[model samples]
Each structure stands twice: as C-alpha cells, then as structure tokens.
Target: MGLHPIHTSKSYHDKDELGPEGNEFTSREEVFDYDFYKKLASDPKVLAIGECGLDYYRLEPETAAKQKESFIAQIELALELGKPLMLHIRNAYGEALEILRARPGARGDVHFFAGTWDEAREFLDLGFTLSFTGVITFARDYDEIIRNTPLDMILSETDCPYVAPAPFRGKRNEPSYVSEVVKKIAEIKNLDFEICRTALLQNALSFANIH
Candidate 1:
C-alpha cells in the first residue's frame, strides 16, 4: 500500500489565522501557537512534522530569529508526538545542525538537501537520511553528495510542480516523475534501478515508521 503523510511547514506559515478561502487573514499573533500544531499533528494521517526549518536564503536578520523559534517548536512537537520530521533547511545548515544536535534522539529526513559533503556528513552522523529532488537530474549540484552518501541513507523525491527532472525539465512535475530521479540516483550509485528504488522505498517507510 502507498502510505503517505500529511506534510506541511508550520514554521513558514503566517502567524495569522487564515480565512476559509485561504485568502483573508486576521491579525498576526505575538506568540506562535504550538497548540494549533499539536491538534493537527495528533491526527493519525499526519505522519511527520515538517517541511519546516531555517531558510536564510534571503537573510533577514529579524526573521532569522523568528524562523529558529518556529523551527524549534516544530522539532519539539515532532519529538513529543513521536513522529519523524521532514526538514526544509536552506543556506543555514550550520544553524540547523546545531539545533538538531542539542536534541538527543531526534530523527528525520532532510528534504531537498543542498549542502556540502561536510554538512551532509553531519546530518548523516545524526542518523538523519538525506533526500534529493529532481534538481539532481539536471545540474551536477548534488552529484558528489549522492555518490558519497550510502544507498540506505538516501531518499529520492520530485518536489512536484517544481524542479522537473531532465528529459522533462520544462514540463510540470508529478509524483510519477520521481522514477527519473531514482534512475539518476541508481546511475550515480552504480546500482541496478530496481535495487535503488527498493532501498529508497524502504527508507521512506522507515523514516515515517510505517511498519
């Protein structure tokens, strides 16, 4: 069975309560509400707590502290609920690593990982799986990281509707297109396509604790 979870980023979502149509909103809260997250994450369908983390791509000093505040809340939420995390770290690996390192027994996958071998190594050392997207199918961006990462510790994804893989780069993306990402990973790791595919599936299952 294809068991997937309800994934989202509470860290980046606006603090204001969104309207029913999702366009209108209320005044932003001074303190972010972990209670709202706690209710949603308690749902059985929600397997992970994230797509959340630091993103210093824009480097707004004020937002950086806020981002860390939201990130740590989600991290604690994941740990409290006994669910895995799906991190969305970008241009702030060191900070992300520091936060995660302090929390013993935290486990998850770092989605769309775009970091150096050293950075990836630190995450791997924490027993977190590193996930790659269709970005690897075109640019040589993460080829070395893919080559160096162990097959079992790697996960393949498509980041659908964005970053379409090669041979279909200009078109819209979908979950089915993940096959190309898997194929590229197999090629990088020099393993049979089926072997890589199976290992990745196993990793996903293990990451979400779908025994």
Candidate 2:
C-alpha cells in the first residue's frame, strides 16, 4: 500500500471558506500556528510539518513578512522535532534556500517543485528532495531537472484538485492520478515504470523516516 494520512499544517496562503463545516484559521495567529503545528507534528502519524513555506507570487510587502515568519517558525519546529517538512514554495526558492541554509540539518520535500537546476541543486545540496507534480505531464520545463535529479532524491505528488495531469487536465485531481506522475518520471529518467514507482515509494518512506 502507498502512504496515507500525510498530515500537514497551514500554508502561506489559503482559500476563503477553506475547510470542512466552515472551520478555518480566522486570524494571523491561528493561521501561523507555530505552537499548534509543533504539537500536531509530534504525533507519530503526522510525518511532516508543512504545506508551509514562502510564496512570493503576489509579492505584497506586508503579507510577505508574515509568510516569512510562519515559514521560519515551521522550520524551527520541524528541526526541533526531527521531522521532515513538506514545503510549498513558489517564486521564493532563493529566499527559501537562504533560510534553509541558516538552519542546518533541515530537510524536506519541496512539493510541486518547478525550480531551475541551480535552485534545485541548492536544495539538493542541503539534503532536500524535489517533488514533481502533475505539471510535468503538461509542461516541459520540469523535464531536464527530473533527468538530472538523483532518483533517490526525487518524489511524486498529485497536488490534487489543482494541477491535474494531462488527459485529466481541468478535472479535479485525486491521489489515483499520482501513477501518471510516476510514469512520467520513469519516462524522463528512462527507467522502467514499476522500478521508478517502487523507488519513489521507498524514497518517501526513507525521507519521512517511516519504517
């Protein structure tokens, strides 16, 4: 069986009416739940402490500061708890890299990573893995990076209800489509599909330190 219940905490940005039964983080303190996340992540089943990181896409000065604060707080929590992070970075890899550099031994999977080779290498150097998403199925930008990234340092994700793979584009994504992502990775790396699939599963297990 594949990994399940991969719990994560707040991201830098969130949608309106975002959670079940209308429950949501209603304030800056609640949204950037550093203390709460540390407690949540301390659970043995909560393998990582994220879906959290910097997002400079809109680039608001005030919002960016809050994002940084939340990001760094989560980094500290993950480092202290000895848990891997599940990062969500966009247009902020350089800044994220600098922050990570300051925190040695901080390691995690860069979810839906679409960074340049130099950026990817910087994270890789810091022992982070680049997780590819359904974007690779429709875009060619990620091809070279996948080819260059070490198999053991690579991961697959659906990023579901968002970037659904080709042939499923415009449809809400589900975890079942992750196989398409692994197949694309296998194609890019010129490895057999099953071999690539097994390797990715093992990579996730090891990265999260799950037995």
Candidate 3:
C-alpha cells in the first residue's frame, strides 16, 4: 500500500494531548518549514507530498498566505520528485484551484471535498480527482454533489481519526472505515457495492500511481 503524508502545522503531540482544538497549538514556524518536508520526503514509505493545502477557516490572512506558500513549495517538491500530491482544502478551494491550474506537473486528489457542482467540475476539468469522506453518508445537502459526480472522478477515504460515518458518528475514524464511504457512494449513485468498491480501489491505486 502507498502511504501519503497528511501535512499540517499541528504537532502530533498536541493532537494526542488536546484534540481538534489543539490545532490552535500549531505554530507559524512549524507550518512554513520546507526542510522538514525534505527529510520526510527522503523516507521510502512516503509516497506523496501532502494533505497540504489552505485552510481559511481558522488562519489569519498572513498565516493563510504562509499556508499557501507551504502548499506551493510542496507542489514543487512533488513535481521534482515525480510524486502525486494529496490536498486538504477547506474554505479555500478557489485559491487552491488557482494555484493548481498555474502549476504544471502537479497531480493529486482534493480529499474530503465539499465544493459545489461547478467547483467540482472545475477540478475535474483540471484533471484532479475528488475524494469523498464519510460526511457524504450523513450530510443531506451533499446528496447532489455525490449524485452528480462521475464515478471516474470519484475516490473515497476515511480521513481516518477524523470523519466517521453514520452509526459511528462522533467517533474516531480509521482506514477500515473506508468501507462506509464506499457503501454511501454505491447508494447515492445506485451502483452495486462490489462494483463501486472495485472501481474506487482502482481509482485510488491510479491516483497514488501504483501499478
């Protein structure tokens, strides 16, 4: 299995101690350092350079700009190393898409995507895959986005230790929970569970560049 890094400024220590609010503990210094990623990229198990992207929800303008810079730097690294990217965009899809369209040799998924149909189409047009998480299973509003998105452009992730599906709502998520996402997509698109699972497995493999 290919392993992808979920880049964030929050320290794992802080996450372990404080939870999501612990994200507030993240320092600007920790967020902008490319040298850290250089060391991480050297690891053989690290397949991609991200879950890095902009988060306008909590960051100040300057901090958000720094996040964008770090994201671009990672994009460059992915280009140089010929690896795919794993993006985490929240409330900054426009900015993320702008940067992505401007850069060449950058490829990856926009994980846990919560954008509109037009926005989704834009990303698809730019050749990026859109990954859905367990949110789609419960969020009534996401039905249209789930239904409209083509199967080829669809990918599923648990975003584990995070967004868990129904019946397990408000619980810590794990990679095994990816099955829930698969089931939801199958229901939304009126597809067979096995077919959806196989197709998504293929999509995930292709996006990660695994032969």
lDDT of 2 by residue, 1-211 (tens): 0111111222343444221212333233334556666666788888887787876665655666667777888888888888888888878899999999999989899988978999999999999999998889889998999999999999999877677787888677889999999999999999999999999999989987887
* TM-score for all models, in order of appearance: 0.85, 0.85, 0.84
* 46-145 per-residue lDDT for model 3 (tens digits): 7777778876665554566567777888888888777778887878889989999999668888888988888888888888889998888888777788
Whole-model lDDT, model 2: 0.79
Show model 3 residue runs off by greater than 4 Å.
Answer: 1-28, 31-36, 42-44
Error of 1 at 208 (Å): 1.2
Order by TM-score, highest first:
2, 1, 3
Candidate lDDT scores, in order, read 0.79, 0.79, 0.76
| Pairs of residues clashing in candidate 3 | 161-173
Candidate 2: give the clashing pairs: none
TM-score for candidate 1, please give it: 0.85
